[model samples]
Target: AQSVSQHNHHVILSEAASLELGCNYSYGGTVNLFWYVQYPGQHLQLLLKYFSGDPLVKGIKGFEAEFIKSKFSFNLRKPSVQWSDTAEYFCAVNPRLSGGYNKLIFGAGTRLAVHP
Candidate 1:
């Protein structure tokens, strides 16, 4: 079955530090990729997405990712992150569904602890 996976279960960093979270998916056909972030006590919001066109895509909050078709990877990266950037990052994928609302499958979860 097609699914998305986040390699990092937990990450710790200091303010103004760089951030990189690994993400991967298992799918052989066309698919839509997305990165959703959930701040403390907040709901999930879209960070970035890759549907078609260029392999590299940028998202809000200074976050970006590259879609490498060969590796089946879409890793999130940030040059320098602030304390506010600390949140639970989730990697998701939208696969073609035969029925239903074509829900999103999220990664297990990644808790990012950023210290000031």
Candidate 2:
């Protein structure tokens, strides 16, 4: 079993400000990590994910994440953020299991506020 942890519960930033959200997982075996975002009144959308191959992956909306195996982390980063970026971010991990089925364990979530 694995759990996800997000370092920052909430974050505030201004337009053009750089953004970084920390995420870590507990499982040590083959796993898949994802970053999901939910706007003020929208469904959860995938931001980025890391499964295999390259450690770094880029997702929609200028979002990117680096998977550091040693740290068991997949932190999200954006060089410059916009007011539209205001949303709740979540980190999730999917552990490999038998029967070819797995469930995602998500973090508490980080609420982001962007000011103009």
Candidate 3:
């Protein structure tokens, strides 16, 4: 079965601290990986995506992720985080199928708390 999983359900950090969230997916074939963030009272926004080219991809708001094929994982990382970064993070994937647009399968959710 194809699925996505986020290890951390919630996280707490102080301002200017580093952040890393674990994300793992189950898929044997080609897939598109993505990290989406949803701030308080806001719609989900794309943080980063790994499509075809490079394995390491960077996204908006100083977020980055490295796609490890062998591990079937694409973990998000930020060297420094702010209180404004507090939000919910969801790891998603689009599995390639026969036809039609691929649908995004997201993990449960991860709540990030950044203290000032």
Location of the lowest summed lDDT over 10 successive residues in candidate 2: 95-104
Candidate 1: stretches off by over 4 Å: 97-102
Candidate with better TM-score, 1 vs 3: 3
lDDT of 2 by residue, 54-87 (tens): 9989999999999999999999999999999999
- Taking the tens digit of each residue's C-alpha lDDT, what string does model 1 give over 8-53? 9999999889999999999887778899999999999999999899
TM-score for candidate 1 = 0.92
Model 3 over residues 1-116: C-alpha lDDT tens digits?
78999999999999999999999999898999999999999999989999988898999999999999999999999999999999999999998876858799999989999999
Error of 2 at 58 (Å): 0.2
The per-model lDDT (C-alpha) reads: 0.89, 0.94, 0.94
Candidate 3 global lDDT = 0.94
TM-score each candidate. Answer: 0.92, 0.96, 0.97
- The lDDT, on a scale of 0 to 1, for candidate 1 is 0.89
RMSD of each: 1.6, 0.9, 0.8
Show pairs that collide, candidate 2: none
The lDDT ranking, best first, is 3, 2, 1
